[model samples]
Target: MVKKIASIFGTNMAEPKGETAADRAYRILRSAILSGRLPTDRKVTEAGLAEMLDLSRTPVRNAVGRLLIEGLLQRRKGSGLWCILPTRDEIRTIFDIRARLESYAAARAAEFATPLQRAELVASAARMALLVDEMLSDPHADVVPRIDAENALFHCKIVEAAHARRLELLLQSTIDVNLVTLTLQAYGTEQRMRSASHHHEIAVAIAGGMVELAGKAMEVHILSAASFVLTDPQADHPAPRQGKMPVRPG
Candidate 1:
């Protein structure tokens, strides 16, 4: 089981000190969901996750309840749980909201980023680009998950630089709910490479201090990803009830 999950998620939790068991369980399962390591339709039991995490079922149960409330997981028929996979419309609509927030964030980042912040964002972008190249050069390499992690890091930096707490909170849930995460993994190599290039372009635009260009680049980056999800047959969950973004979903 360890080797199987490692093969899928590429890593495991280290049982960090100072956190409660439920906290640890939540983080582990959330990461697995974002990276698609836990398939959406696969029903999992509390006993299973507790065993997997080397914890009593109590912590796993508590964590599962939290995820259920957050709409990241769903209660199955009878008694079960499954990670929620978003629909095509939900994914696309989330990106639409993301575009509005992040494009403005890029402009603010350009306007506000200190030299050190700018440098760090550029470095992060470079790492994402390198991962894309690595993935493209080797078709079988399990680099998708790594790129997903770096992609989060790279974009989080932009929000950090922007210094907008409200914007960060709004975007964080969107990012965490697997909107951006699922979109990237859904892409083919060409599309992923294009996304990697957009990350580079966003970093360059901000570093160059071009506020408008930075915003435009960010918008284009997110919208392009939304376009991809709209075409996916698997993104076919019942069209989410009318809303620009399902901020809270089930």
Candidate 2:
């Protein structure tokens, strides 16, 4: 079972140490969900997770509670915990919110970003370009998650450059949930990857203090992503599973 979990997450086991069991369980479960190994909307139980992780129920419960707060897990009365699969309407709503927040962030970033922040943004874009090239060369390589992490890092840097704590926290809170679903659906597709590069372009414009271009680029980038999510067949028609909510076809 340990080997199975490691194989699924592309990791090898390490000796347990001072880290809390809840933290360990959360990492394993979160990675499995984001990688699609656990599958969207699948039912989960404390007992099952505890057994699989070779830990007691207490830590599994703690992890589940935290995930529930994060909107990654749903608890159904009389039924058990299951992964949360956002409905089409919910996806649209999330994108709408993201669009507004990210566009504003780009504009603010343009006005407030320091020279060092701008350089960091450029460096991140260069890193993304490198990752994209590597992914194109080797489709089966584990580049998706790496790109996803880097992408988030880039965006976080932009928010920080904006120098608005409230805005940064709001954006940061939603980013993980948004990326988990987006990466699950779009990571391997050529069109999506190309579209993602537009985000890099936007970041460049922002770093150069081009406010209008930065805002427009951000709008275009996010709207393009939303369109991909809405139209992508894989996202709309996830594989069938027993006793879980069905994904609606696009």
Candidate 3:
């Protein structure tokens, strides 16, 4: 079935200068995925998407192929192309990779972090601890969202402190999957406190220029959080559709 593009812009609008049809399709599709408008497991067909965007299949195919290569899209036999539906092992693997990259970032943070960056790391941890404290004092304080926001700030400051833009770029998608799509909802008060304590240790190690300790602290922080997610039956994740070829056990 053909779908015409919406009249967000009046008819007879031409493609922007210096942008190809594929480029235009790609930006729109990526925005949909990133914004959760096209949630995980939602199917996409070349013809359908091409028609929806008022583009040709050749360009739509090109755009989808690129997203597929980036791990944002996956293909199943019956399901065709769909948003990512990660399995348990896939989630674990993502964390493993994050742990490694973050370890390196933390170590570098210790060695190369500026005084201002170290101060920010400490502040980030302190702020996150305050959120945990608030949640504990009033269970219905409506602070989980605050904690999630601080969680991103806490880790991001560490990575950004290292002055490694390339590393940050590499970890952006994994971080988004955790911070944006998934969350720390699986953690209880005790777990939140433990994770908070680790952040403090990380901040201190970085402040004191303890390279190995800083790195280990970061590793522990991530793995500990990942443990909660893996064990939580209700953890937010993209579930694999049944009847597809099963992913091998890890």
Candidate 4:
């Protein structure tokens, strides 16, 4: 069986200029796993990935280690690495934790953020909004990753502004990149727009030093994500497919 790696990375597997082999491997695999191109039940190994990616084992091994640490990949007792699939309750709990931490972060950002950081948050949110609009217009465009990256930047900027090392560390454990990707993929136009709007609102509130307003906006935004996941029919991820995936990059 063969799969088009291009379908995962939105391009052939050629390493981009300035990207190392390991970085390329990580990007390719992360996109596949997060986008659900690599099914939850599909087991993978570093050696097998190296061969399929047309790379040496060393780079693939490094990429695999990173994914394992990020909680995107887990090793089963009798299996190799497989994509992690959280239960509904687990998903809810993750969002709940995120809500509390992020709301506080937002308030702190409102209080302590530098001028440049505030501008960056606004820009990031605006970028995501534009991308969402593009996605709504051209449903076939592969811009999910672009938007996801922007969303990550937006959140990261907020945390950086918070100036709390412990909060940043806590968020590292709570944020499931794979789940976040899946959630975005599942979002309808309305949900996506609402999310973008929330980002904008949070950014504005923080930038204006409205601490309570920013905190409330952040909490609402996070809870809205939870509500969408719990209610949306397409939110349940982890569909298992039986077969060998592609052996070579497309």
Per-residue CA lDDT of model 4 for 29-138, tens digit only, reads: 88677666666766777777898888999998899889888777897887777877667877888788878988999999999999998998888888989999999899
Residue pairs in clash, model 1? 88-235
Q: Which consecutive 10 residues in model 4 have the weakest lDDT in total?
A: 1-10
For each candidate in the order shown, give its overall lDDT on alpha carbons. Answer: 0.73, 0.68, 0.70, 0.77
Model 3: how far is 149 from its true place, Å? 1.1
Query: Model 1 clash tally?
Result: 1
lDDT at residue 161 of model 1 (Cα atoms): 85
lDDT of 2 by residue, 1-250 (tens): 3332222212323435576989898877765655455645457777877877788989988998888987778888977777765566766777787788888888899999999988888888888788888888888888866676566666667777788878866765655463444444454567546755886797789878998888788878777777777776655434332343222211
Error of 2 at 232 (Å): 1.6
What TM-score goes with each of the models?
0.75, 0.79, 0.65, 0.77
What is the model-wide C-alpha lDDT for candidate 1? Answer: 0.73
Error of 2 at 241 (Å): 13
Can you give the lDDT of residue 182 in candidate 2?
44
Model 4 local distance difference test score: 0.77
Number of clashing pairs per prediction, in order: 1, 0, 0, 0
Worst 10 residues of 2 by lDDT: 241-250
Write the candidate numbers in order of decreasing TM-score.
2, 4, 1, 3
